[model samples]
Target chain A: MQRAKAEFDATGVQILAISTDNLNGPLAMAARDGLEFPILFTALDPSIPQAYGVFNLFGDGLASASVFLIDKQGEIAWKSIGKNYTHQVFPEEIIEQVKKLN
Target chain B: MGAVFGRKNRVLIAISFVAALLLLTVACGDNLSGPSLTSGQQVGAAPSAEAEQPSSAPTPGAATPAAVAAVGSESKSNTPPATATGAESKPDASAAQATGADSKSDTPPPPIATAVSKSDTSSAVAATETATPTGTPVPAPAAVSETPAPTSLPVLVNTPGPVAMLAPDFTLPSIQGPEYTLSEYRGKQPVLVVFYRAYW
Candidate 1:
């Protein structure tokens, strides 16, 4: 989220977005949208999203949308899996959650 | 015996024809309507399942977000945030920047892939269905499909562990040169991993 970049960086929180699209698509998105963070390309394999459990329910590649808040020690601190794809984890909410982890 | 065999053969032929027809219909959903739908019809087709996806082929700047991509990055001077946008404009500048930033990244060959195959692959989705006739391009909330009411309800999916459990550690490449490992970032600082469906 380019809009929340300052806040995320201020908190020392790194943001990474992994998509099933090729690195090219993500690269395109980053440049056009002025994304300051990292957006990884998964190619055809859904490893990142699958492990993150975005497709924990139904569908293929990327299914249900989800956010994972993993702590410094790589423990599950908080996770919000949207009921539907459109339900997003807002920046303010994430900012609060990140602060609590500190 | 010959008459009985002929009768059975005719029944099998009829069944085969029906099966072939069904497959053809599903496979040709795009051809059936995609071409006919002028930009005018594409306005409505944007959100329609008939436009479910051109195909799953990975394209640079061509993945469709599950619903909407709201990448309207406003002026956040100190920190640059990547807001999602529904429009999938060509990322000439971004791709160049990406290549410039990361030397380690093996530059992917420019797609000789015609922009036309986009009808076949989900990649190449320029603007989303919500991209208005007015050209303002609104990022509407992504719905699962034409009828999203059913999927809007909660459903079960596998998790490495519950909220308190240790997250599974794995490595994924960063768009930049570095590789992201869950374990590496653990002791240093908090990391949030966001998996977007695709970029529309």
Candidate 2:
């Protein structure tokens, strides 16, 4: 994420990272990892993850890692849902999906 | 002294055997919980999909992709083979179930907004065949309009274009500053939303 932020920004794509952790943990993580893109937390309100159909997906009372590419018209252009705790979409796959968009 | 040492050795062996039994019991317990837990994940999408299967089969325009994505992702940990196979057969119904499930969060199925490109319409037609045989051809229009026509239902959305599922709108506080609303970026820029399971 740190490496691809500038490239994503160049393409006018905003990267928003939402975590299942509470407010403070993600805040500290952003500071620790030097995450420049916006880091949003869903601990206070979990409706966001639930909306995306990923809340408690792994049965650990937490969200499975996932990614959604929302087009300019607010429609989901591409999405990859994590099947387990370790699953995640890579930066290259994300770039590829972004390129597919108009 | 020799007699006493022999007795102590027997006691040590007994203790080790008891410890081994306890470890095996815990391992077996986890094995038992594993299927139930994984099946719980399947239940989230399957039951709902199964419930709406009959009604949602005809309208595969906008919902096909989402259903395909859901089934693809969950295929690996498919604990219940029955639901997985059933979901695979008719993903369009699962798409409606997905919309219904997420409706509480205000994430409606994507409204087919504009004319689908020739290639897209062709592909959507191919996809529609998996859901229904008598798929209606989507009417590709030339005129561009800013306001999306209120084509919400599958019965009424036959002519508009291919369906695109919309992301649910959300507003949440960020580490950077004040809250961010997802819909605010619509029509301005595309957004990449990432959900992470923070280790901390």
Candidate 3:
């Protein structure tokens, strides 16, 4: 997603990644990848992913890979839940979904 | 009468011992082979079950034990799952960069890789299992843009209204030390919320 930062910025979409990992893991990741966006961790309460319906979707005791495009009104405009835990929606596909919103 | 009772007791004891031994063997066998088989089955069944989740009215309290278990195991297991190797390369590099960027001596990369690699292998497998194993990592599929979004809208979770449903409000802390409320972004700018199974 770091690769598409410029494109996402061009579209006025704010990218927020919720990491199921502990705080340090994503903190280390963002720092290492020079991630321009915020990578939030649910250390305070791990239910955030469950709220999103991404948690334990794979039953591997982990969140399933998923994406939600929330419009300015906070309603989900489009979403792609991975066919499997490993099936991630690519950044370009995300950009395409965002374009559809406009 | 005493002799008959003794014989019956001996027969019963022998039968019970045999049954116990059989159960022991079965239990041991299951322990030896169950993980891989169960994991495979769960992988196949998960998608079908997950597809139905969005239609139900989700309660924030209906969290699963698996999610809690994942978090509990997060700090304990340092060894990466066996499946991690095929897909650990990219994240391992990023982890190395993380190690350097944070200048912390304690953070080991393997655990993070291990937790994430189990599922990530699916994508890698999806990519290379049918196609050639290129040195390149996951490429942004720009060409795929014209195609009906590469991922299916298999699940429409957390939506209730005829149109779009308001995302459940959340006040999560970013790694950068600020609280982000999902509803706060309402009327501000479109937010793309990506829930990554494991990222580090």
Model 1 alpha-carbon drift over 4 Å, by segment: A56-58, B1-163, B198-200
Per-candidate TM-scores read: 0.44, 0.48, 0.46
- Number of the top lDDT candidate: 2
lDDT of 3 by residue, B1-200 (tens): 12222333334433332332222223222323333222223333333323432233142211112222222232232122212212423333332333334222212333233332322332222222223333123222211221222121112222232455677777777888787878888898989988775552
- Each prediction's whole-model lDDT (CA): 0.46, 0.54, 0.50
Per-residue lDDT of B30-133 in model 2, one digit per residue for the tens? 32333332223433534344344335566543333333223332232222222422333443333334323422211211222111222233323433443655
Sort the predicted structures by TM-score, highest score first. 2, 3, 1
List candidate 2 stretches off by more than 4 Å: B1-162
Question: What does chain B score (TM) in every candidate?
Answer: 0.19, 0.21, 0.20
What TM-score between 0 and 1 does chain B of candidate 3 receive?
0.20
- Per-residue lDDT of model 3, residues A16-94, tens digit only: 8888765677777777888988877776355776666667666766666778899988888888866584686778988
DockQ computed for model 3 against the true two-chain complex using alpha carbons? 0.32
